[model samples]
Target: MRDCGRTRWWKGAVTIADIKSSIGELYAIEQLARGASAVHRLHPMAKLIATAFYIIAVASYGRYDAGGLMVYAFYPAVMMAVSETPCRFLLRRFLPALPFVLLAGISNVLFDTQTAFFIGPVGVSFGVLSLAVILIKAWLSVTVVLILAATTPMQDLACQLARLRIPAVLVMLVAMTYRYMGILSDEAHAMFTAYTLRAPKQKGIAMAHMGSFTGQLLLRSIGRAERVYAAMKCRGFHGAQRLAPARRAAAADWVFCVCVCLFSVLFRVVNFSYLLGRILV
Candidate 1:
């Protein structure tokens, strides 16, 4: 019985450590943005517009056009390479969002049963093709967004939003909401540490205590937010907070944006997958 208790405690400690590590990794994108690579050096507005345009183009593909969607992967592949972003790291972030995408894809698999193609003996349904397209679109969209986030600071992105005439209140809310995530995580970590210290023998928090624990966490977070807002007010925050001056787009930035928009249109109109097959045949 004593040995069993010790084993449980050990597992609990390891779980807590993993949680702490994940919390740290949450801010890894911010750290990656600080890199001095060419992609990282691009103006935030340029990257933002390019990313949005790329995603829009990707999402505009037909349900069974998986082959054409393959070409869209080029954007993320090249951006990841240029930005020097690690595939495995972005993949880890992507995995969490996979289940939701899978749920949507799987529904198509169950319903749309018309045959779209056949390979030798096997008939592939339109649903299967649609599923593949969904998966591909999800990968491309998530990867490009991750790449943009990794290369450009959130503060810069928010400032660009302001320049784009997003309402000042909306801009401030978005920026503060992002910053608030760090605060919430920090509070959760501190609370977990304190709980573990207080309940050294317990393997986990008791279910009966969960309500009180969560209530306390909420109270603590609210208090922290209040103090933060007070400090902001003292510092002359006027409804909206601008982290940095909006960067004017350089000639290179305009060139980059134009090229991205042009390539997006090119990829949309030209089915490179079919062209590749023709050449191969």
Candidate 2:
């Protein structure tokens, strides 16, 4: 049992390839945003505004009202299909965010036992109900943001943020941080690979070395940032991001944004599923 456990742990350990692959995934999504398809062609501001409203609607639901959350899944499902995004890829990207959500949810399962409903003869409690709500909310929220990213170029999105009257420094911070993720990720990957090559059979960095290992990574990342900034300056990069030339939002863009926001607000107010079930029976 002990040997099997060790093997599983080793197998599950993250590698350089995994880290690089994540960077590749982000690059792929950014490329996807450049496509000429309908969803991609929508104004960045429209998509951004719609996404904000959708998130607000999703987050407004009560913890025990998981059924209403099911209806909200329509947005992500349709967005994935219409946007031509691979569901598996987005889900893989979401794995990191899932754990904390699950951790919070699982506590409700163990602690809150008040009866909430029944699945045929099986009784369900508020705990289980809340867990389902939390999971659905996380999935919906993440998917909405992913869809926004998949459809809107990062610079354009940043531009819309600026147009919305967000502070220039804050927008620059968001843009710069996002711009540096790929670089930092590559640095970390290289350090991890070099560490592994020297001690091939070690499961991971030793606890004793964790501080030094992370400090080295931080130092390299900072140096890389300095070099990047110098290159930017050489190219005449100002403190501002050069947004794409703004164009008038066509009528269709306004219609699309309004419809989506209206529908989201409608769903938040009405339990359409329950009403339909009642009328039919």
**CA lDDT, every model vs. true structure:** 0.86, 0.86
1-281 per-residue lDDT for model 1 (tens digits): 97677657666554534655675776888899999998999999999999999999999999988888888888889889999999999999998889999999998889999989899999999998899899999999999999999999888988998988999989888788777877777777777779979888666565567789789978998898899889999999877765678767899987998899899999899998899999999
lDDT of 2 by residue, 1-281 (tens): 87557656767877556777878888888998987778888888889999999999999999988778788888888888888988887898789999999998998999999988888999999999899899989989998999899989888988899899898889988888888888888788888888989977666665567799889988998898899889989999888766666777999999989999999989988998688778999
Which candidate number would show the highest TM-score if scored against the true structure? 1
Task: Report model 1's TM-score to 2 decimal places.
Answer: 0.89
Per model, state how many residue pairs clash.
0, 0
For model 1, what is the C-alpha lDDT against the true structure? 0.86
> lDDT, candidate 1, residue 165?
91
Q: lDDT score, residue 266, model 1?
A: 95
Q: Model 1 — which ten-residue stretch has the worst lDDT? A: 11-20
Models, CA RMSD each = 3.3, 2.7
Residue 174, model 2, lDDT: 87
